[model samples]
Target: MRLYVTPASPWVRRVRVCIDELGIGDRFEYVQTRWPHAWGTRTVEMPADFVEATPVVRIPALVADDVTLTDSHSIIDYLDGKFGNHRLLAADGPGRWKAQETNALACAILEAQIMRRAELLRIGADRSDDFIAKMRDRGLRCFAALEKQVPSFGDAFDLAQITTAVACGYDDWRYGPAWREAAPTLTGWYDTVAQRPTMKATEPAETPER
Candidate 1:
């Protein structure tokens, strides 16, 4: 399997952390993407070749002998089912649903943050102020809700733990550590995860575009 991803992407980080945690890191080659630049400066669009390779104009596209999967959640599902030896998601029942629910919330928070960043990059103030504010509020509300729900995990790193950690990390990267003051429980959870070797290995850093 091969994974085309950007190191700074939390979606890619999730997949990388999972691969390392599940001890399948040796199976795949990690390809740092050049398509975003190939498309255009400061644009989300990718070139036709990249699109043909992976329809989603995003990072963490997994390509195997018979499968080419995009989207973080779908990649996770594929990995878990293929490598059932180390199950991150619950095999069945309510626990699986709970994990899925947390994943959904985390993804929503990420999407909001991404949108906010993209809007900031736009050359003009052409976007609706109300829309941006609503997105910001939605992200904050999701973080607050996670703070309440995440405490149940205690000291273990499961799917919920990984997803929430990535979400909080993304917030700190795109927004700032101010979110910590508002959501202490989530702060603690993320701090604990940050110490883990897997999370540390996948941490994002800002860089000038090449």
Candidate 2:
């Protein structure tokens, strides 16, 4: 299997973390997608190799023996089905639904942050006070809701934690570490999550040129 990813991407990081946690890193090759040092731009030409390969040009696309899957959630769902004993997504019932729901919310938080950051760079403004306050408030609200719900997911890493960690990690990387001050419980949760080998290995750092 080949996993195409961009190091700074939370979506791609989620997949890498999943593969690492499953102790199956050797089963897949990780290739860097998106040009190095290129920011806020994407070129969407299907490679001659993958012209019939897949319809998507996004990162975290997984190429299995005969199948190509895009979207991190779908890719993880496939992995969980094959290698997970109902670990990432619950094996049955409402638990699966809830996990999916939480994952969606978490993704939204990350998406909003990404868009906000893009806007910041585009306009040559760090971040507008009103813009940031709105985003921070939204993130905190999501964080609070997750904090109350995460305890029920039990000890081992779950989808909720993966999404939460990636979102918070992104904030730390692109925004400021002071978010730890605004969301302490979430920050503490991240600290514990970061101790996992997968999280440690995949944690995003500013690209060398940045």
Candidate 3:
């Protein structure tokens, strides 16, 4: 199996950490990609061959079981089903929905963060204050909501918890500590999660390779 990642993306980090927790790291060939940019430069460029392989040309793609898997959640589903850690998600029911909701919330943080990043990338004259503010507000709401929900996460370390932690880490790395003041509960959660070896190993650089 091959795991292609954009080192700076929390989406990719989610997959990487999942692979680690599943104990399947040995089966995956790690491939680093500089998507939406070329090696620390502002130029947007997906790897030529990767673009040819998938319509979306997104990173954190997995080539396994003789098929290509796109999207972070899809990969999570695959691993949870096969690996059956029993920690990634609930076995079924409203419990599953609760986990899914948390996962979606965490993913939403990244979505807003990515949007803000793209907006920032626009040439100064083209950037819109309204759009940037919208993204920032959206992210802020996500952080606040997740912070309130963190206590319910309890003692078990599951997929939702993992993703929530990744969301905070990504924000800290990409945006800044401004969120810390808003999401204090999540701030405490991240302090512990960041110490996990998987997280330490996959931590995003403050600046991407570009």
Candidate 4:
């Protein structure tokens, strides 16, 4: 199995952390996708060889078990099913529904973080303060809710926690780490979560994995 990823992507990092925590890293060959540093102003294209397998040209695509999984949620869910000794998603009932609900909220927060990141990457006049402000406001709203809910974060460290952690990590990486000040409780929770071996091992870097 080959997992295509980039070092700086939280989506890829979340999946990597999941596989590492589940003891399934040996089942995958981590393929670091590269784009031309000289693409200049044009949108980047998938490196030629990887284009066919990844329709969206995104990271965290997994080629495994005779199927190609192209999204982070799909990849992580598949890994959990195959190798999870302890389940990330609940078996059924309220716990399952709650996890799904929390995950959806976390994912929306993650999207806001990414949206802000896109705004930041634009150069000078190309950047849009309106978009950045909107995304920043949206993400902080989500963080505010999560901060109130932090006391309920158990020690289990399941999918909801995984997504929440990565969203916080990404916020710190690209958004001036202001969320730490804005959401003190969630920040405290993340400081503890960041110490986990899987989290420490997958902290984002510019260097590509071989």
Candidate 5:
């Protein structure tokens, strides 16, 4: 199996953390990708095979045998099913729905953070302060929602927790500690989860632009 990744991507970090938690890191060959400074402008030059594996050109793409997964959600779902026996995430029942709900909130936070980042990276004149403010507010709103859900997180460290932790970590890495103001409970939970070896190993960094 081959997993295409970039260290700076919270999406790719989620998949990496899931693989490590499942103790299946040895099962994959990691392929590194880069983000060009002209990210939103022109085509990115990625490996031919990676392009073939995911025409949409997203990172965290996984190619295993005959299966190709182009997104973090699909990759994590496949990993949980094939290597984790549904341990990372529930396979059915009310637990599955609950996990899905929490994951949705976490994923939304990640989306907002990433979108905010993209906007921030734009040239001064090209950037939209309104959009950036919108994303920041959206992310804070989701963090508050997660704050309410934290008490019910239990001690499982499942997919929902992994994704939430990733979102928290990403915000810290890219946006600093402002989010902690809105989600103090989540802030406490994340401080401990961030100590996990998997989280430490996958910490976000700058991906060199092309």
Candidate 6:
């Protein structure tokens, strides 16, 4: 199996953390991909087969045997089912729905963070302050929502927690500590989760020049 990734992407990091937590990191090869800039102005040169595997050109693309999974959600689902015995995610029942709900909020926060970064990358004249502000506000709103849901987050470090931690980590790295104000309880939860070896190992970093 080959996992295409960029260190700076929280989406990619989510999958990496899951793989590590499942003790399946050794089963796959990690292929580094890059964006031209931190805000993903464009992709750096990529291998032809990688392009074939992920025509959409997204990170967290996984190629295993005859199957190619694009996008972080699909990759994680595949890993949880195939390699993780549904440990990262529940197979059915109320637990699956609860995990899905929490994951949705976390994924939304990630989307808002990335969109906010893209807006910030624009030139002063081209940037829309209103749009940037909208993304920031949306992310904070989700943070608050997650804070309320944290108590329900049981003992297992499942997919929801992994994704939520990734979102928190990215918000810290890209947008600083402002989100903590909206999610004080979540802030405490994340501080503890961030210490995990998987989280520490996959900390976000600058995309290197190819």
Best by lDDT: 5
What's model 4's overall lDDT?
A: 0.80
**How do all models score by TM-score?**
0.88, 0.82, 0.89, 0.90, 0.97, 0.95
Winner of 4 and 6 under lDDT: 6
The 10-residue segment with the lowest total lDDT in model 6 = 35-44
Please, what's the RMSD in Å of model 5? 1.0
User: What is the lDDT ranking, best to worst?
Assistant: 5, 6, 4, 3, 1, 2
> Over the stretch 1-210, how does candidate 4's per-residue lDDT look in tens digits?
999888778889889988887877887888878754322245676666577667777777888767898889888877887778438887678887877877777888878876776667678797789998999999888887778767777779998899889888888776667788778989988999999999999988663423
Q: Poorest 10 consecutive residues of model 3 by lDDT?
A: 34-43
How would you encode candidate 2's per-residue C-alpha lDDT over 92-150 as one tens digit per residue? 89978887777777887787786666445544454476775677777767766666665
Local distance difference test scores for all models:
0.76, 0.73, 0.79, 0.80, 0.91, 0.91
Query: Can you write out model 5's per-residue Cα lDDT over 1-210, one digit (the tens) per residue?
Result: 999999999999999999999999999999988778666545768778889989999888999997999999999988899888999888999999998899999999989988888788788798899999999999999999999999889788899999999999999998999999999989999999999999999999998666
- Give the candidate number with the greatest TM-score: 5
Instruction: Quote the positional error of residue 110 for candidate 2 in Å.
Output: 1.5
Backbone collisions counted per model = 0, 0, 6, 0, 1, 0
The 10-residue segment with the lowest total lDDT in model 5: 35-44
> Which of the two, 1 or 3, has more TM-score?
3
Residue 149 miss distance in model 1 (angstroms): 0.8
Residues forming the 10-long window of minimal summed lDDT in candidate 1 = 34-43
TM-score of candidate 6 against the unseen true structure: 0.95
Cα TM-score of candidate 1: 0.88
